[model samples]
Target chain A: MKRGLITALAIAKKDLQTELRTKESINASASFALVILVLFSFAFDLGREELYAIAGGLLWLVFSFAGALIVNRSFARELPNDCLDVLIASPAPAWSIFLGKSVAAFFLLFIVELISLPVFGLFYNIHWTQNFPGLLLVMALATWGITVVGTAFSAVTVNIRLRELMLPVLLYPILIPLLIGAMGTTTALLQGEPMSGEAIASLRLLIGFDVIYTSLALYMIEFILIV
Target chain B: MREKAIYLLAILAALVMIPNLKTVFMDLPDEAMQGAIYRIIFIHVPAAINAQIFFTVSLITSILFLVKKNFVWDSISVSCIEVGTMLVLVNLVTGSIWGRNQWGIWWAWDLRMTSQLMCFLLYLGYLLVRPAIAEPTQRATLSAFVAIFAYADIPLVLMAIRLPNVRTQHPGPVLETGTMAKEFHAPFGLGVLAVFLICTALILIRQHQETAQREIDSLRRELHSI
Candidate 1:
């Protein structure tokens, strides 16, 4: 177990180091998120309230879709050098690899969100002072939920023929529940509401999703990587 | 023998649905609130129920396939996907028509409707992912896993849907109350039975064709080896 954790962290470190050298995943993700935010801001050019009302969904849209891109690239990056094979052949369990890859994805996405959210706030004139801590909490939990499923599905679709196409098709549907929770919580936060019943319900849903999806992924990763 | 039973059931299902349609239109009075627009219930409710049952069957067969490593179980799962997806599409269209009549909107993100849509997407994803993986065994395992995963998360998704039940457009569960009127019960019972029979017959027939196709593929491979 101790060695498994070490192997997981090592794999995560290896991924981050490779990312540092290439900056492939993060650069693409940040730019894609920015573009989505820009386009949505333009499209909702009608009124201020309308923009504010949709910012939560728009922000999450950027995160979710760009996050899918990051997941696709991270695994595709492994294919050229066969690093994923090496990782699997190592003394670590496949679930540990899932953990490692998910950990790396979490940070990669966090960096993108850190850069993108402020721009979103600026464009939409968001008052970050409204439940900022709760907003941060929502982003963390929701991103974790996304990362957990994204990492597992990245592995699942990496070997398919239409590998690029398969990732989003398989993933986004499963991510709907998470997106609902994240969007609802973010909307509530943006509206300057206290953690009301609906917000609490959405939070609990996110927490539930993170637990269920993570455990299921861990349980199922070994089966997924059977090839 | 299974094929024969399937054909027989198919004919019986067709026969039953004839009266089911008549009862819905000519005999049963319009629902008090929605008027004649509620008559779509004969088609919509039966298809919706069958779609859900088909999904559950897929889930069950998928679990059995995973446990037993049986190709026949996978065939059943695949058949369920095809039939279930088609029926869910029907449900969506019928519900949309009814919604437009009732709510003056083509679509509303209600819990039941949205859950049905999500369920449809999950099944569609399963079908889309099927052709991407080339290896037969790997495909079976992966698809079966997807079926189970979709089934397992359904309750969670339903709970998430209902957490903020802002739109209550569709009616709640009917069979659960067990207080349904006798006049309403008879035709609905037949409608439900007809749809189930049709679904079963389709799956069984498809399962046979799949088995035969597998055999032919194996024969082609054998001839090539010779």
Candidate 2:
């Protein structure tokens, strides 16, 4: 078990090191997210009240697209370098590989969210200091759930033709619950409304989703990678 | 075969139930608001139950395929999903038509409708992913994975709709259990069983055809190599 943990961390560290050197994916995705947010603000050119009201939905929309971009690139990166074959053939267990990759993707998404929050706040004139922690919590948990399923399906789509288009088509429908839950909680927090029982329930639902999908992904990763 | 007989019986059952369905339709209580237009429940309720039946069968078959690694179970899973998708589409169309007369609008993003639509999309995604892969083994493996994942998402989809903030005109859980429960019991129960048998027969026939096709293709490939 300890060996498995060490192997998992090694794989995760390798992905991080590679990203650190390249920086292409992180830079491209963040820039894309910023551009979308800018365009949306201009498009909606609403008064302050309306802008604040719609801020949560817009922020999540940017992050959702950004998250998709990051996941797509990460999965694609494995193919060009033949890195996936190495992972598949390694002595390490398959779940470890799934865990390591999911964690790494989660970290990348977290960084994107960090940059996005302030940009979103500045554009919409919404205060972040009060809700930042809760927002971050929801974002982290929700990103984990999305990435777990996203990573598995990303691997599946990678082998198909027109993989880039196939990934979102296959993914977004399955991820609707996570999207709705995250959007709801974020919207409530941004609006400065007290978290109702329903909001809390949504957060719990997201947590449950993360646990179930991650575990299922871990168990099924071997079948996916082998076939 | 016994399966064939079962299927014939299923057809007979469906035919027999049609007259009973008409009788129930005519006897339904007039709603205070919609008057007799509420009679759309005859078709809508049966379609909705059958859709659920198909989905549940698909889920079970998926689990069996995963555990047994049998291609037959996987084929059944695929067939059931197809049937389920059809049933869901019918339910949605009929429900919308019913909504029009009752609510004065053609459609509403009611909780039940939204959840059912999401369910339909999930299965549609499942169907799309199946044929995209070229190799038989790869298709089965990937689709099995998708089947499991999609089934897991159903509860979450249902919960998202059940949340309070999401507004919809569909009656809530209580209405399903309290008001419409007794009225729906007999037909729904019979319809569910009839639909289950029919779906099983269709899936078995489809599975046999797939297996036969695979055999013929292999034979042709061998002849070519020789």
Candidate 2 chain B least-lDDT 10 residues:
B172-181
DockQ of 2: 0.64
Q: Count the backbone clashes (under 3 Å) in each candidate.
A: 0, 0
Q: Assess every candidate by TM-score.
A: 0.93, 0.91
lDDT (Cα atoms) of all candidates against the true structure: 0.85, 0.78
Model 1: per-residue Cα lDDT over B1-226, one tens digit each:
9968988998999999897888888988877777899777777888988988898989999888878888999899999988999999999999999889888999998877898899899889999998787666788888887887677667778878877656677665542454555688788889889989988998898888877977787788889899
Query: lDDT tens digits, residues A1-227, model 2?
Result: 78877877887787777887998778887999999988996787698777666776787788878878877865678887787888788898987877777777778877988898898888778886667678878888888987788888887877876777777777888888888888878877887766678779889889988988988888888888887
Candidate 1 contains a number of clashing pairs equal to: 0
lDDT of 1 at B95: 91
Worst 10 residues of 1 chain A by lDDT: A41-50
Off by over 4 Å in 2: A194-196, B6-10, B24-33, B172-176, B180-185, B216-226
**A28: Cα error in model 2, Å:** 2.5
Worst lDDT run of 10 residues, candidate 2 chain A, spans A48-57
